[model samples]
Target: MQKPGADFEDELENSEGAEELYERMSFTVDKGQEPLRIDKFLINRIEGGTRNKLQQAIEKGHVLVNGKAIKSNHKIKPGDEVLVYSETSPESTEIVPEKMELNFVYEDDDIIVINKPAGMVVHPGSGNYNGTVVNGIAWHLQQQSPELTEVALPRFGLVHRIDKNTSGLLVLAKNEKASIGLAAQFAAHTAHRRYIALVWGDFEDSEGTISGHVGRHQRFRKIMDVYPEGDHGKDAVTHYTVLEKFGYVSLVECRLETGRTHQIRVHMKHIGHPLFNDDTYGGDRIVKGTVFTKYKQFVDNCFAICPRHALHAKTLGFIHPTTKKEMFFNSELPEDIQQVIEKWRRYVSAKGIMTEG
Candidate 1:
């Protein structure tokens, strides 16, 4: 017979979606054990777990018995097995709070808004254990709420996140009630988020929308792809308006109706206008410019100036968790993006002059 939790670990290693990151623990009931509610049994067996947290895990289908999912009320019999999984992976090292600088765009009793720069990971994971936004926030919180020192490590109030290469504004809750409230807004798609992207090609229309199901790539798990037939993945929608045209490339503002991993990057690629210099989506090449050596060098220079995807989370809006008041925040483009845009403008002007000559 298979061990109680071994099956779950195997399943998680092969499962899709959020479970991919989960760390699992399993328990086997003794042969002489009496019938007991799974949740009640787990409270005694699992150290430092509350009935409420375990119940929530059960409700989310993270708990299993005898290699099958079970509810909190399920009765465990002698010879039965149990497994529990948490979304976060088990860390070998402790998460120490680093006193890093944070660009606070807005803050109050309930929440804190941060202008995250490119290259800063939102949270600690795998090889990146510190120097993340979460670490900084933990230090800030420890200072603000000295009580937090008594809690567990890696305790963060983050509700949503942006990519490591994508610079932007992000909001995090300071308390559990605030976290729950912010999460509901995100789940309902009521929060407003707008991104500015410099894409490879100009659009015929000034504004448009891209609708597709966004999910992980079939072969490459690291990247996302669009399912046009809606056969797979979750529904994602992005509304874009052309802000400026540079002939070969255009600047556009994209408004997101739904948030998914790499949604903007994948959708833009689907429309044949991958973000300029986006290394992952084939934007690092000269997608729209001439093959001339001079043009190639110019494009290469632009790539060096930006060194990452030309996308910025320019604006964010959501309702305050405590005050229930509407809040909106905006950020200026980083110097690298601004410099690359200027370079494009000059390149376009020189090209026009050559054509006239």
Candidate 2:
């Protein structure tokens, strides 16, 4: 959501019958407060703001003490200036319909599944103000065929999300009941998800599993790290098997035992075999030599044309939300990724390398 700027005060004053309130706090540590934690002090001083909220504010770099943002758990000394700025929640905007194409895989009264192409955002955001998967679904529902029911625009129930760059089978619910049911399935780790990926490595073993608690890196927001002193992290499990192995590249199938944000990407990176062309996580190894470097230009062009991670959601299965019948859906590889795979195969074959099963 966009942040309110200089006009925030005027807009707040002119808001109809409602006033947004903000409180600024400042403090100086006492003689005995030398060892007090910054967050603790804020909780003690700010009325109605809990330690959790204060910590969130501080970690988000919203808390300034002596004109510097301090860590939530940082110790406070005898003399320190503290400031806190709070704002009202931004007004929610109704998702608008856009004339975008959608590849509908399956649809029922309770749920809908789409073969979401790579580079398509699951929802709307700043850089993507239109042409989102949700926007397409909204538009499609508006032009519902006589075979489908009249569903409301701006109301496709999304249970979870894939990264904007990940192409996959995505499920949406038709109503709140289906949404809640599918959400419960995800929470319970019973929903099945499988992905196909190309990684920059050779694997001696055919299969393996990765299990760990993943959290955002302290220094690099884009990277995830296995945290021993865990914060808002959860245990994630991924089972993978080698499908094919080029001398320097391996095609792998990853099955999620527990889905978390960037689970496959982080787990593969943690295993020292990050996905091919994943610039954010050591993808440089995939384009080292002169031949691969020349090939890399074509790969990069394809990626830009596709504009997404090479990962694809290959399979998804779950029980029907209303009928209780078991359901499953699988998608063939998108043509772009298929072509890349064939090119890699040719490169390996020319070198007399045996492809892995």
Candidate 3:
């Protein structure tokens, strides 16, 4: 309801970033500082920031306790270290929707499925506005039904999102009933979503499950971490099987039980097999000369063409909200990813290694 982040506005006016103005304070709770909420901890530590600003920081996830972001009322235990970023004061600007092209896969009265391409951001925020998936969807919806007013623009009711760089099948609800139905399926873990990823190692088993509580990474807030079993994090389940083995690389399909942000990438990385070409989760530094060496330049060039995580929503299954019929949809790997897999296969074949089956 309030502006995205008051600190964002503060940053624009101050000219200097939050790092320059705000001093990051770290404190280990002693007997006197026993238990306190995250916001209360910030109020006591940070000097210039107001309570309102503190709340904004908490919401934006800039403030962390014990390496985890917490709500304003989150109770902090002893030994918890709190980190707060400096304030930002940027001016508010009108968000004008720009025209963009959308590849429509399926559309009906209540829902639409799109094969969102890599490099297309899902929404408008953080130095990106035009040319996003949302903008494109908005444009398409407007053109599809001109009788609908600007206020009537459904923007293709976003039910869930794949990362900006991950290309795959994404469904958008056309109305509220469909949106609620699909969202509930995701919440209940009934919608079967599967992804295909080329990771950097040969897993031990033909199939296995990785389950853990998923929370934000301790140092890099953008990345998710597989936390020790606990309450603050939600249970994430990933079932993976190897379709083919390429010595140092393996093509695998992963299915999720809980749809947390970066669930597959985080879980795979936790088990020592980060996605191929993934930089944040440790796929970028994979030994290039191994399988993908001959086409290193080509692969690098392709990565630049679509600088996204090398994961795709290969298959999706759910019951139709209106028809009540079980439905499933799948997309082949994108050209860039397909090439990576092909090259790896060639390398493995050259070495006389057969498919894993």
Candidate 4:
């Protein structure tokens, strides 16, 4: 379930049936790619696509170029958008609408904002194909209009994404036009997003910015890493303000400048302040605290209170695609985060050395 990348291009394809190939894969021809047969182009991109299977798919109108069915010999040109609307891989393709509970923050014809809980993945992928944000959205759309129940909502429903363990607010586009508008806003850095995180250290400065190039790690291909002085990854910026400082940890507010994958988590780790309980970047342990058994037990209890990364998407802002008006939404810290903060607050202020940002 690794994302398609330069090192490992492991994406979909299978020869189960040409007709079963659903609208699963989307690819934009690179500006530098020379004219090549559509079949050849796809076989190279799809992990297990065979020449015979692709030819069969083309005959059955499973392949589209610029939104039109094409023959296998059709030449692909630069900037041409190719889409495979087949169940090349059922898990990633089939949009099964499993009914599940979700916190609906705001809803309208063209958009919906959801206060997603932690442990719920934003979309279907890898080990989790059901009980995701997408599944819930599908069910909601179906329930809103019974006629549409038989059909799956287009992939445009998700305008942006957050990590599975990161809980917070998310705005989803209900249509293609809205998707385009919102996507442009995110790409241009006009959309605003803020997160609250508890990191494993106290900061000397009240506020600061962390900027670096974020891309796939060379060793751990699944997770992201920082390219501080290299040109291998996308440029990312995260501004953070210390909200409150405990003896061994601090509550921080992060406003993202560029929404790279895991931007806040990566930037915080780059500065040696990984989010507490974030196991991926090594924040699960007591980084700066007493070695005594009592303090260890206290930290362990806090971990149980949250049981996940101590991060939350507190605010999100964007322009309404249809209304042409600025839209903003905020969410209170979830109960897990609130309880942990209060626990630290009581522990820190026992003496008079605690400081607030």
Write the residue-wise lDDT of candidate 2 on 74-157 in tens digits. Answer: 877777776675532232265667787789899877788999887777765444556777778877776765344433423326
User: In candidate 1, residue 38 scores what lDDT?
Assistant: 91
Which one wins by TM-score: 1 or 4? 4
Off by over 4 Å in 1: 1-94, 150-156, 353-357
lDDT of 4 by residue, 1-357 (tens): 223341321211111101111224789999999999999999989888899988977875657789677888899999998977443233345667879999999999989999989988776654555788888888888888878844344355555677778889988888766765565566556789999999989898999999899876878765678996567777888999999998798999999877766778878998999999988788898888877898899899999999888999899999998898999999999999999999988887886756677
Clashing residue pairs in candidate 2 (N, C-alpha, C atoms within 3 angstroms): none
All candidates in order of TM-score, best leading: 4, 1, 3, 2
lDDT per residue for candidate 3 within 292-327, as digits (tens), equals 555576556656643566788888888887787888
Q: Arrange candidates by lDDT, highest first: which order?
A: 4, 1, 2, 3
Best by TM-score: 4
Model 1 misses residue 302 by how many Å? 0.6
Residue 115 deviation, candidate 3, in Å?
0.5
Listed in order, each prediction's TM-score against the native is 0.74, 0.69, 0.69, 0.76
Per-residue lDDT tens digits of candidate 1, residues 53-92?
8998787566778866677889999888787765443332
> How many Å off is the CA of 121 in candidate 2?
0.3
Cα displacement (Å) at residue 278, model 4: 0.5
Winner on TM-score (2 vs 3):
3
